[model samples]
Target: MAKFTDHDDYIAAAPEQFRPLLGQLRSRLAEVLPDADELIVYDMPGFGFGKSIIAGYAAFSKQCGLYVSNAAITAHADEIVAAGLKFTKTGLTFSPRHPIPDELVTKLALASRRELGV
Candidate 1:
């Protein structure tokens, strides 16, 4: 595999299994941050608004990650943990076989935007 520095490259480099999910996640992100500028960052898809450091999405062999860059994500760490969130070399993610709850995602996005000063 080739080294990728941003999201587009990462998407391109990712295997077939990740393509569809990656696209779905990307669409969801856009829906959440419609006006935000989007690009590839940290070898993953990132959405930026007033600032560049914002949320992102990335997929791996096991599952995909919906990155909420705000420190606020920690506030619900306990709940997420109970719901199966965990520390990974990358970040938090749901298991490959599990579907992320829409309600949880809404909460996370709201928290993330608040952290971003949105």
Candidate 2:
């Protein structure tokens, strides 16, 4: 729906279907990087830890794009390619209709910590 540049803005603009999912993602990111400076940049929910960017969450046309801003997934591109996952250098292109990869998300969260020095 509408674009939001902060959490409260997101809460107000986000669609109902995406709310719970976004909340879960937000909580997960928070738990993973408690010391990070969480902000809503680029109209998406993003977390900034030190000079590093941990991750961000967004509801797209038909999927929720879970973004690891530091290009952490780039390092695993080959593995992702072999696994048949469609992703870019920034984030995994996943459908919200399907289940989220909690395990991989966890790994990315940890990587965010390292990248951000958190």
Candidate 3:
């Protein structure tokens, strides 16, 4: 595997099946927070605004995830669950074969930005 020195590298180095999923998630996040900085943080592709993480995404062997804070998930658990995606304390997971909803992505990203007040 290639070393990931940055967000785009991390996405490009993901499994071929996961690349599109990661790209879609990245694009959605960018749409919501165009000023956020893209970074490879803690081994995942993430966005930051003034040192606060706005959003992130990663590819696992069987799933891809959109990562926000635990605070964001706690505040919006019902809405996230209603979207039929599985979210842990820190992020939401979905199969690469199934594209996650763009609206839900935008909503969650905006909520995260609000949480950070950035």
Best model number under lDDT = 3
The residue-by-residue lDDT of candidate 2 on 17-115, one tens digit each, is 777777777777777778778886666778884445678877765667777745578666675555556777678765546535566667777775566
Checking candidate 2 for backbone clashes, the offending pairs are none
Among all candidates shown, the one with the greatest TM-score: 3
How high a TM-score does candidate 1 get?
0.71
Off by over 4 Å in 1: 1-9, 88-90
Provide the RMSD of all predictions against the true structure, rounded to 1 decimal. 3.2, 3.0, 1.8
Where in model 3 is the C-alpha error above 4 Å?
none
lDDT of 1 by residue, 44-68 (tens): 5677763464567767778777788
- Per-residue accuracy of model 3 over 70-97 as CA lDDT, tens digit each: 7788888888778777889988888754
TM agreement with the true structure for every prediction = 0.71, 0.74, 0.87
Q: How many times do residue backbones clash in model 1? A: 1
Q: Which TM-score value belongs to model 3?
A: 0.87
